[model samples]
Target: MTSTEAPLRYTAFTSDPEGGNPAGVVLDASGLDDAAMRAIAAGLGYSETAFVTRRDEAARRFRVRYFSPLAEVAFCGHATIALSVALAERLGAGDLLLDTSVGEIPVATGRDGSGAVVATLTSVPAHSRPAGRDELAATLSALRWRAADLDPALPPHVAFGGNDHLVLAAASRERLADLAYDFDALAAVMREHGWTTVNLVWRESPERFHARNPFPVGGVVEDPATGAAAAALGGYLRALGLVVRPTTIAIRQGEDMGRPSDLLLDVSPADDRVRVTGRAVPIAQAGA
Candidate 1:
């Protein structure tokens, strides 16, 4: 293998290569500067890519950076999951400490029921605040959704676990499924509000949910699998007392897009910690 080869690619949150959010993984990015990483990520055209600058084998610690097509992100949950799975395949499944732009993120690796490698990430402290009425109205207009379509149970709020996300729970699954919107308009609103994505979701049941994320800020129209948003959603749900304490909720995402991704979330009321779990797989090169 050449020392200067391009980064490895992998899909996160799904077992199938074509069914998850694809991300570029640079195992050894210590030599690549910010410009180089940005170029590489842009060339790949994925929602986000992860660069591992340093790794501690015995300590299972990694210093990582995430780059979207346009700019560097504070933290990317899917890319972190992919990196953990990749590291687990090589170093054996265990725990990992990640140093990120936002804060230190702790991740663990294990096997799922089907024996697929699953990585569970414990998000940093999460908090949510009510969204401004004017901003909320603007966001709703950009999304082409009326306030009536919103679920009364879940009020509008800007939630943050790692990145800021606008949480708007839909009144029905159909409202969440119909996701066509003004990309530029929504992008402008999100940019103005400093939101990473708009987390549109619907509660199918007390413990199950359907979500779709519009990520125009990241240069992607939509994100099939979004773990960061999920973590934020967990915090929002708990803070609002929408769910029973200490329960695991299943989040179904990317289904409308045909990718079909699943995320398991455990939220505890004792403290503001949300644990999200998903699987990742390496994407085979043209000819391996």
Candidate 2:
């Protein structure tokens, strides 16, 4: 295999190699250009892959880029977690500052209760806006969902946390589970709106939620786990005053996909940046 093809593979948001969102990590991608990175990510067939273009060991800072199979992604949360754990295993756990397309993201890595390395990423300033009626109608049409399927409490909104995500809350867990959508239609709508993903979620309780993301814009039908979307959800709740106080939410995703990924989100009424934490495990060559 060529140097560009030999990226380290890891699955984020889960400790098991077989679960979570798998991402390709190129530790030293300084030599690779945009085309090379895109090609690598395309061949790997992951939702997104992370490339560390430049690293400053002294300051623990790096310039990173993310690419999906079809295009460059502005930011990717799962890939960030995957890369952070990979770095910690080799360089030792610590704080890392990543300069991304959107803005700088701060990540902290340390051992969890299970003695497994977990990474928490503080997203860039997050905000949300109500989705226009026309836009919401178009998106719902693409997803084959009707107005009745939506949760009245959580209105449709376009949220930003490094990238733009359309947050749609389902009225029931059953509605969230039955995901059948037009890929081409959804891709066209997402591209037109410059949306990174459609965050479809069902709130099980005050602090727990189940989610699924349709990433047609990335050439992926569905993402097992999406950290960017999770962060966006937090921002959406805060912006709408849904979160009255500081809260930590547990997001269960990828269960329907059989990947079973978990994401922890911390959000506060006063804080604009949301914190997402998850564990990652390396995927062996044979498994990859």
Candidate 3:
């Protein structure tokens, strides 16, 4: 509590402590430099950790930074949710405006029907473009997946929320479940294209889907729940006219990994921004 020592750990996108992506939260990182934050994030070994550099209690505004094990990231969705839930526990549920490297993100925290704190984040302007032939081929090769394995309906696209993500839809659930890929090759492709994660998904229904994210760039083999990618997906779907009308989709991630996270996305053609909602829970310290 004194100038941010060890970070407070929390899991996002799920109610269970053990069933979501875990992130470290440094509530007051006022004095810590970049090196210190990077070192703390690397030591914790999470996909991403959030540091609150400045806070305006009266305004409910905060400036934050995110770091993965390898380096600082522009933005991170799960960490944002985790941090918001953590703050809500202390400040009570309401609205918060976060100043991040990408842009200002508006987040609202409230209790769900079960009385569990849930955080909903509105992403910045979102958009997407079709992945080029060479880019698609390289990504498919790196994933060891053939072009035939892709779903024709969801063409390959590079989508953006706060960050960029490669969205690929699998033809079947089996293809989505089998996720072994060449780490070095995929990482190279991602770096070349500036993709944060490869969002591999399978459509179960009009409003439900399963997703898995390969995040080699962040030095993680996989991400259980990715909020930024989810927002990007909403943009992708809407931009491509996949969702003809306003609707909400349920994205089930990390089920294969046994973490089992749930993310809800509200997408409307009238607006470009995506609303992603999820619940976060604090992780008890070891032997606490």
What C-alpha lDDT do the candidate models reach, one value each? 0.91, 0.94, 0.95
> Over the stretch 1-288, how does candidate 2's per-residue lDDT look in tens digits?
234458999999998888999999999898898999999999999999999999997898989999999999999999999999988888889998999998999999999788899999999999999999999999999999999999999999999988999999999999999999999999999999999999999999989999999999999999999999999999998999988899999999999989999999999999999999999998988644
135 Cα displacement, candidate 3 (Å):
0.7
Q: Report the number of the highest-TM-score candidate.
A: 3
- How many clashing residue pairs appear in each of the predictions shown? 0, 0, 0
User: Where's the lowest-lDDT run of ten residues in candidate 1?
Assistant: 1-10
What is candidate 1's TM-score against the reference?
0.97
| Model 3, runs deviating above 4 Å | none
lDDT of 1 at 99: 94
Tens digit per residue, CA lDDT, model 3, 1-288 = 645567999999999998999999999999999999999999999999999999998899999999999989999999999999999988999999999999999999999888889999999999999999999999999999999999998899999999999999999999999989999999999999899999999999989999999999999999999999999999999998878888999999999998999999999999999999999998999787
Per-candidate TM vs. native? 0.97, 0.97, 0.98
State model 3's lDDT.
0.95
Ranked by lDDT, top first: 3, 2, 1
Which is the winner by lDDT between candidate 1 and candidate 3? 3
Name the Cα RMSD for model 3.
Answer: 0.8
- Model 1 misplaced regions, further than 4 Å: 1-3
**How many clashes (backbone atoms < 3 Å, residues ≥3 apart in a chain or on different chains) does model 2 have?**
0
**CA RMSD of all predictions:** 1.3, 1.6, 0.8
lDDT of 1 by residue, 1-288 (tens): 122787888898899988988988888888889999999999999999999888788998889999999999999999999988988888898888999988889998988788778899999998899999998999999999999999998899999989999999999998998988999999999999899999999998989999999999899999999989999999998889876668999998999998888899999888797999999998998878
